[model samples]
Target: MPQQVQGVIARSKGAPVELVTVNVPDAGPGEAVVRILACGVCHTDLHYREGGIGDDYPYLLGHEAAGIVEQVGDDVRDLAPGDYVILNWRAVCGTCRACRRGRPWYCFNTFNATQKMTLEDGTELSPALGIGAFMDKTLVAAGQCTKVDERARPAAAGLLGCGVMAGLGAAINTGNVGRGDSVAVIGCGGVGSAAIAGARLAGASKIIAVDVDERKLAVARELGATDAINAREGDPVAQIQALTGGFGADVVIDAVGRPETWLQAFYGRDLAGTVVLVGVPTPEMTLELPLLDVFGRGGSLKSSWYGDCLPDRDFPMLIDLYLQGRLPLDAFVTEEIGIGDIEAAFDKMHAGDVLRSVVILDGPDSDSGSTNPLEAHEGEQVSA
Candidate 1:
């Protein structure tokens, strides 16, 4: 039987998301149904609403989610009912060229659930990022469910599913930030701040943060930025160079994704330094950079897709670090809200008032029911 549940959906371009009834089908082959516990409101969701991602209207938003596996379909072995999991968009297909080369993170062909969740009238709703989760329950490919340490709270752990992972991976994976290296991150938003945290975790000697907003820069400092530069005050490129002892940072990350910020990142790094672009830009936006400069710069310019993260590998380790208090995941949660408060959360995000506004679906008043059947199962392997 199809389960009728409430979900947030952007029915049209530039339209407000409506909490409508979404009929989630039972788990089909290689699919699983997850009972959502918590989900974070991300900028990508807003982009979807604005028609920046695609023309996929009536998109079921909210992807940064943690949940419990309520049911698994045929051929699904690793995940069973009652497993706690973090939902990820990228589910690597092992036979893809990238995966065949032992680089699953770069898998060109990722997986989504074969089945679709529809509305009351049978209108097929496009799931945001292939894992629409702003509901009591969502259907997804079993591979999309990455099991993590249950001790890590749902609000913090779910962040690794999207923006946070992108930022952290931009530094640790794509940028190759190393010990004693100098690093700089542009735009001190959630993703940028996560990059700073990643650089700190990697033992970067000096971490610089550049942002137009002083408030975000302050947050970046708490996330381990050694220096802050207000881009509005002066030329950010020159300031970055000056802060890095007149050379430039070894790695520069542009989290704003605009052409101007891209150029700033290009000129703000030392020669032969890596520049990671982790920000999402619009379709109409074009980047104009001097071809001569591109050739003159001796380092790689890389764009991170979901932080180039392999959920099965990175999720467990990062969660362990968070549980040990080594990773301050809690710092990302600016507020907790109910499902109906997502519109207000979007407003807060637009006003730059919060790093993340998470929807708590496990509260007493939540419409979601407890589906975990393993609570009494002692010694259950919960990690990875």
Candidate 2:
């Protein structure tokens, strides 16, 4: 049966999101209904509110989410109701050229639900990243739901759906950071910090974190960065080179996505070193660089889309790692709030005051950002 659930929606460009009843249709072919447990408040959602992603008005926001399958429509396979799942925006079509070539990560024909989730009046809504998970329930393609360990904390596990996954994939997949590699990540936000953690997990001997904020730097160290550079105080490239014994890092990640940061990352790597760009740039952003520098660099420059991650392959493995305490996924979640706190979470994210503000709809979540991993980074509160 079609049902109504409370959800957050941005009705117009630059308007505050409204908590209203949303119409979620019964799962159609190849789709499933997810009862959301936790969803992370991310900058991309803020971009939707600010009309940055598209002119798609009345956007259904929230994508970094964990939930349980409540219903599965026809043609769904290998997934059943009551599965603990993390929702991914990309649900690759198996017959796409990319998928047929065994590189589904570059799937050009990713998909979403065929039916629209709408307003009470039947106004169709465009979902952010093809996922509208800020509600009690959301409908998604069955392929979008990656089942993970049920024992995982929903607040912590949900982070894997987007930013965290991107960061880790930047290092592990795109960067190919390996044992004894000296890596430097520019930007110490959620994504960058996850890169640092990924570098460490990949056995990077020296992981340097570069950022303007001191608090973020502190958290970076806790997440396995061996050195921290205050980008505001000195040339980050120079600092990264200095820490890498004047040779430059083996891998440099531009998590900030700006021309300046990209340039710094280019120069911050050693000869033939890899440069992975995980940051997303605005459409108006442009870069003018020397052609000789590109030719002389003699290395790979890669852009990671969703960290080149295939959710099914990565999500469950990551959750297992988290459960084993090998990954500090909990560190990324600064606090847990209800659906009403989405707007404020955006404010805190913009201010660089928090790594993540998770919206917990059910199950236990942190009342305070007091996890063992967040001890050093915990100080100010984003809200009362």
Candidate 3:
């Protein structure tokens, strides 16, 4: 039988999301149904609600989530019921060309649940990034479920499902940040701070964090930034150059994803240093730089997608590190919120007030009212 559950849904573009009853199908071939424990409110979710992603209406929002597998499809082999897992958007198809070439991170074909979770009226809904986790439960491709240590806090561990993983991967995987290297991360948002943490985890001797907001810079400092530069106070490029002994940093990551920040990253590194662009930009955004600079730079300029992460390989390791106190994943969770607080959380995000406002699915002490209706007629009549 299809499960009726409460979920956050963006019924139309530029409208506020509502907690509605959704009909989630049982796991089909190669899929799994997960009982979401916690879901992080990310900027991307706001983007989807604002129609920044596409015309896909009735979007089931929220992606960064950690949960337990409740059921698995017949063809799913590696996962089973009761497994603690992080939901990942990219479930690399092993037979894809990228995987065949040993670059599973670049896998061209990713997987999502074949069936749609629908509005009670039987209207099909698009799951955000194929995870759609802002709910009591969600269904996803089996490969999207990466098992991690159960001891880790769900709020903290779930973050590795997206932004945190992207930042860490941008520094460690794409930028190839190494021990004793001088690293500069431009943008002190959740992603930027994670980059700084990644640099620290990778043993970078000098970690410089740049941002327009002083408060964010403070967070960056706590995350292992050796120096913080408020862009509003001075020229960040010049400051980074000065801090790196006039040679600039060994690696500079642009976490702001704008042309100005990209240029800052380009010039904020040594001649042969690497520049990694991990920030997301809108489709309408275009970047222009002097042709001479592109050729003049002797090193690489790269863009990181989902931090170039392979969930199966990186998630467990990160969870282990988090458990051992080697990585401060818990620091990223600035607050815990209820499902209905998503809009307010977005406000805090836009105001630069919090790193992450995680939705604790079932609060430790209380039983929030279930959004699901017991009867099919009740389910179908509730508008999303």
Candidate 4:
């Protein structure tokens, strides 16, 4: 039987998000149904609400989430009911060319549930990043569920589903940050901060944080940055160079994803040093550096997609590190909120007031009488 659950959705482009009756169908074939425990409100979710991601209307919001496998289809084997798991967007298809090459992280054919979740009126909904989780329960492909230690809190562990994983992987997997390396991260938001933490976890001797906001720089220091640069105060490139003995850092990551920040990262590193761009950018944004400069850099310039993470390989290891107190996953979660507070969470996120505002779903039928959560932004175009 299809389960009737209360889930959040953006009914149209730039319209307020609506909490409506979502019909979650039972798992079929290689799919499983998960009972959501907690989910973080991400900037990407705000993007969906504002129609920044796509024209896929009625997008089921929320993706960074932790849950339990409540049920699985007959063919499923690796997952069973009661397994604690984090939902990931990259459900790698084993037969894809990327997977066949033993680099499934670049799997060209990631996937979601074959069957659709729908509105109570029978309208089909597009799941955000193929893992719509701002609800009591969500259905996903079996491969999308990665089991981890249950000792980790849902609010913190769920974050590894997206931004946190992106940042950490940017350093460890893409940038190839190594022990005793000098590293710098630009942005200091959720993703950038996580990259700082990743640098620390990778045993970096020095981690430099760059951001326009002072408060975020403080948070970045707590996350393990040895130095913080206020990008607005002076030339960040020069500052980074001065701090790294005039040679710049060994690895510099651009978490802001803008051309300006990218250029700053490009010049704020040692010759042949790696620059990893983890920050997302608008489609219209473009970069045009001198072709000579690109050739003269003499190092790798990389774009980190989902931090180039392999969920099955990285998620459990990160959760273990979190449990052992070696990683500061909990610090990334600034607050725990009710599902109804999503719009306010978005505002807080945009205002740089919080690192993360996660929704803690205690029960399957949880409700706070919120039908429309966008009262604060009514009729106003969300500035990109």
Give the top-scoring candidate (lDDT): 2
lDDT pick, better of 1 and 4 = 4
For all candidates in order, the CA lDDT equals 0.88, 0.90, 0.89, 0.89
Give lDDT tens digits, candidate 2, residues 133-236.
Answer: 99999999899999999999898999999999999999999999999999999998889999999999999999999887777788889899999988878898
Looking at candidate 1, the ten consecutive residues that score lowest on lDDT are: 375-384
Best by TM-score: 2
lDDT of 1 at 323: 96
Q: What is the C-alpha lDDT profile of model 4 across 156-193, one tens digit per residue? A: 99999999999999999999999899999999888998
Badly placed stretches (over 4 Å) of model 3 are 363-384
Residue 15 lDDT (model 3): 91
TM-score of predicted structure 4: 0.94
Q: Could you tally the backbone clashes for each prediction?
A: 0, 0, 0, 0
Q: Compared with the true structure, what per-residue lDDT tens digits does model 3 show for residues 148-171?
A: 999998988999999999999999
What are the models' TM-scores? 0.94, 0.96, 0.94, 0.94
Residue 208 alpha-carbon offset, candidate 3, angstroms: 0.3
Worst 10 residues of 4 by lDDT: 375-384
TM-score of 2: 0.96
RMSD of each: 8.0, 2.6, 7.9, 4.7
Which pairs clash in model 2? none
Question: Scored by Cα lDDT, where does model 3 land?
Answer: 0.89
